[model samples]
Target chain A: MSVMIDTGNYIAAKAAVMARPAVVPAYPITPQTTLVEGIANYVKTGEFKGEYICVESEHSAMAACIGASATGVRTFTGTSSHGLLLMHEMLHWAALARLPIVMCNINRVVGPGWNIWTDENDSISQRDTGWIQFYCSSNQEIFDTVIQSFKLAEHEKVQLPVMISYNAFILSHTSMPVYVPDQKDVDNFIPKRIPKWKLDVDNPITFGNIILPAAYEKVRKDMQDSQEYAKKLIPEISKEWKKQFGRHHGDLLELYKCEDAGYILLSMGAIGAESKVSIDNLRKEGIKIGLARVRCFRPFPREEVLKLGKQADLIVIDRNISVGMEGAVFTEVKAALYNNSDAKAYGFIAGLGGKDVTFGDIEKMCKKVVNGKAKQLEWFGFEGV
Target chain B: MLSKDLVEIVFHGRGGQGSVTAANLFVAAALKDGNKGVQAFPFFGAERRGAPVRAFARISGDEIHLRSEIYTPDIVIVLDESIMDMVDVLKGLKKNGRILINTTKNPKDFDFSKKYDVATVDATSIALKHEILVGGIPVVNTPILGAVPKIFDRVTLKSIQDTVKDKWKGEQGNKNVKATQDAYDGVEVDF
Candidate 1:
């Protein structure tokens, strides 16, 4: 492995090129532009011997990926915020088509106010598109997850698209040191994609016609089954990656000192990583609290959340709010433990619209939850009614 | 305030002045000097030419987990001395934190130098001397980086020159390396 000091976007770009995807089609968006630029550089340098399509829009970008993946070629792309929103229709199409297209979606604030910063709503809103999702905290995690997502997506048991999301400016723009394994190591770890089925002119097959409810329900069930299979396969691939590369950013949920703690705080993306600092500080103050940094959001890690609930009460620091209900993660974790564990879960709506959520702010939230002073949910940094 | 183990720095400059590049190169040099955890990021907003822009950098012996913006910096580097009047570059700086500026004036000329450690380097002159110009405007980022190792020892003048070469190549790279060395020898520190 060689140490690379660069931004998350560039690291991810290197990881994607090293993975050796056959086709990379993308459009530029803030925070994600540099990533694509990095790939273009590799292409220019002849390091990446593949097709790089400069599509006009994100919609066309995904369309290009789907078209390329339909022919049984490995495909990759990236988008964020409005760019991701523009590709919404094709996102479902790619997942439903069962095309194993790996995408790195830089999580950014969905704009009504023309703002550009780190936020989760962009990818969080795409949660139900039948794609396996992974949230990363650091530049290394971003690189590793991008490489691993390709392996997971192309697996036979789990032929589903994977969306790897991370906080935009926090991860995309921030330069950090990441150890990039040799191309031989990466190529050995994940071989080129070999789809079980694909379009062949000689083989002549019709695809994606309208189906009746029975067949449609089976297709949906197949997607769900594939997702369930991904949960099991993600850890397996992660383990093999660690065995070869000597690093593991956890499987579904990265537990931080939660074994014997009475309180477990949960968060995802950059906030999840930041929570570790708060956990360390609180532990020094003699608080029996730990952290569960959710790495894989879908395949939900419901079982792990339930297990943590049985071990300790959960405090979720969600970076995305569902507007009316609460944080999407907060609701999901609460649902995971429904009628199972009596351990209550509290939700703190923090970092929405890219508001700063510092370690000190996290400490305050943890103290509120641990002291039994928190209600079911509250907006952090905002006075409640 | 930053922990003793971590070094947080803020870069202040106008757009096209390479504030973000300075932060990135600073951390890259630190990484080459064997620092494990280093991060550099621009202000999370749109950057326009001639607009005041800020970038942040951090150095730690261990992996950095805190992802928040640098609010309390241990060092502040100003790439454009003219920006110091428009922006509060010293905001949230730790007491006695080192402040480096790209200016022709002496370090003691800055009144705040009496209160905090201050360093000055005529980086614009160094950049011009090395013919490091983009659009006929001198690019002070690399030269200013050479002044950094004087105030912060975690990175070195050698690594700074090496990183500059890594980012650029051939004649252009040699010029940046020389500009960096010139600033290294030219910097004046007052503590």
Candidate 2:
């Protein structure tokens, strides 16, 4: 029923097929190309029954998904940095129209310098786009999260698109053992997309034709309300999923040995996984440090973060920079903790453009935190900052 | 074989030489042997055929949460002997680490750090002997990988054979199995 496989892309593709999406429109990009290619193979081999559309560009890819989603069928798509940026307008269109399309965005650096390496700037820049984001730390998590995204997005209480992301090539190209479930179990988990409103000839409706400013405000408010609803629904669904599948990645944040710790390090994506190793090594050295891996970024996990702030000194590690300011997560955490807690928060920016950030680098950061010599904003693994 | 410590390995080869695939297969084989945690990833900017590339793998007795690139590897597996002339393959290798090179020359002929235990095998010949060629390029990855378990106790030849058989089938699989077994027996290690 389950097998060990290499690459997160293939695992994501397998999960997509098992979810039985009616339509999948995707374009080829570095790192993300293999994901759609695997889907295309499934389609060719007759293992997957979905319509796999090889669109011209990332813009066309999202547009096709939007078109398919409007017809009340389950739709899926995947893209990387520039590809995702190209779908900027359509990203907004899908969210506002309330089409529950699920997409996987491999986090690659946006290029003027032409980099194809891993970075979170691509997805972090889309934080304001109204799409619910889930950052995965492992191949198994990628498979599980992509499968969970469909059920969460399609929930009537939360009809919003979900962007599942992991670092480009780190999880994408990395090989690991992932336990894939049988199709019957997956069917029991995720039901078919049955929308209340759809483009049907018998039941006519108008979508995105014209909206006054006041109506647009209400529509935006409803979207925000659904996001609030999703924050609560995410954990419930994860619990149900765990009850059935025997696995549950913690709701918005996965805390590792943080129950009784003086210092807690916060991170997202692959860096979070690396920090766990750092925490384990640090614990052996008698340092009271732990890791709180942020699973969902769009909802921002305000309560969980505030709870962490109350318990320990928070060290936020960001693979992305807000530019002219500190790291994006640091900025969000600081804003969330304002007037909420007096916990000292330090920001460390690391692994931009695929720079390697190891356990030793993380342990050093923890040591600095322990020494109380950490700056408010520091560039990790950078010398002579 | 189970060890308390994690075994980290770095692979050096050209882009087309299947170093990344070798790394993945190695980890897959380790997982098949019931190792709790395993990870393999490639590090490249703009990869192309004939360009030097690096890939890394880690096999741990416990769950591996570290996703960072391997800095100090326990073993450096060189798939191509020519890459040795281009870069210091021993750069971040541990002082007691082992060097496994796919070369026809003897291990003593090469100048390497005195701390490392060097091993050599004629993987290209084995690949050619097995006629494992992809687009006329002899597939040396499997043969080199086969030599790995011979030198290290972390994985066994049977596990490598089973993984290979699962990956490739029919006559192609048989050829790979034969190449792997031959290389496993032929590898020469100097402590």
Candidate 3:
């Protein structure tokens, strides 16, 4: 039965426990601290039969998960902004080792001037680290994605780690009703992780040791191949998950009222949820605007994005900037549609460091696009440069 | 008064006064009353105990899609009476919006703008009477929340009581329930 719960972190922790990961190694960080704390509570109550280890730092957290996954056991961990960046080397190590570990990363601002607010730059920075990334917009989606991630990552054809991320504090601290499935049903949906290769006492095999340049090249190719395979497997898993769970959050991208839209608002994470309300309000005003929410960022969803580009003029709203260039999503999206279609892509940078982005702000952006006044690269809700 | 089906409320209190808990409990009570959508979130930055804090809640009959902080609220609840001395509690409140404060003074004793409907309840005394204290500070959030349903009428006192019972158990739960009942009956409002 589904119960109303406060915060997506608790739902994620509940889903992780339900997945029955054999090892949970995590360190506390704001926004993500409660996720591991909730797991510890489950362990203390004897509800989850797993080894919960409190690591010294975020680097050690991912390192512990990598070590545990090497032993062929299901492993889970959680971290945020600075913590995730701190685990940069191990993130590559876990992915290159082909460990199908699942983690929840709360998208907080990476700070030189200390901040704890929501921003996507933290996870977006790890796009090239060979992890399948899923950005969730709601608490229910967070729960559903965490469970589906285990299935998607553990598939023999796609043995890559998956990072499930959501806007820090926006989804993390917000209270909402989430439909949690029964443990028996979840177990049936997601079976125990059984690795094809593992560290065995008798076998005596070395893992992640020294390799020649040619072998290293082959490993890189294999990792890319697995990611390409995941693009196909993601939708298949979503279909089966919908059939079993009665909920579907699209495959890589979810389209909202885009059937005959002349203009489309493209966004991700919590901003996408706010855009839904903007689209609804705009539609009532007789504006033909729609929203295409990118759910998975790492796999890029290039094909689906190209299809949407063909449908309407794409206005990309990105919360993370690419420093000297425009928004990260904008740069990639513009490239994705460059040779294929003649879609005018307008990029808007907004909500960095967790500035509030509301339906009113989104409505104005869409109206500007509709009125042909949107710049090639504009900042939403920012008065001055 | 706002005519929209959605009702937004802002809770102003000290960091350790349980204002965030009050916002959560209000949403929980609204959910129990069959309100389809409810949300609550706190806004703070490296706050310590006794520091000014804010939290927001939204209750609607439909699913809520907006995740932004509440810029305009239909009601504002002040859990700390001293907050008004430091900050303007009525900054973004809608015209004809309501203000509920935890104070021993009468509603008209404070110099509030004439546009608002002010209400006051002695939640501190009620918390002390119920012994809902943590570290020598009275827990005034529950009593303040109890006065909310009486003013708004969208959520019921019964729902709040039931939610309190569902969240707590035994004597602790019963004490909170009694505090809620007393605050609901004792709150004085002036329009």
Best candidate per DockQ, number? 1
Chain B alone: TM-score in each candidate? 0.97, 0.95, 0.96
Kindly give the stretch of ten consecutive residues in candidate 3 chain A with the minimal lDDT sum: A376-385
TM-score of chain A in every predicted structure: 0.99, 0.98, 0.98
Predicted structure with the largest TM-score when compared to the true one: 1
Give each candidate's fraction of reference contacts reproduced: 0.88, 0.78, 0.72
Instruction: Find the candidate with the highest lDDT and give its number.
Output: 1
Residue pairs with backbone atoms closer than 3 Å in model 2 (clashes): none
**Position B80, candidate 1: lDDT:** 94
DockQ of 1: 0.71
Question: Which prediction has more favorable lDDT, 2 or 3?
Answer: 3
Candidate DockQ scores, in order: 0.71, 0.58, 0.57
lDDT of 3 by residue, A151-223 (tens): 9999999899999999999998889988888999989888988897999888989987899999999999999
How much RMSD separates candidate 3 from the native structure?
1.8
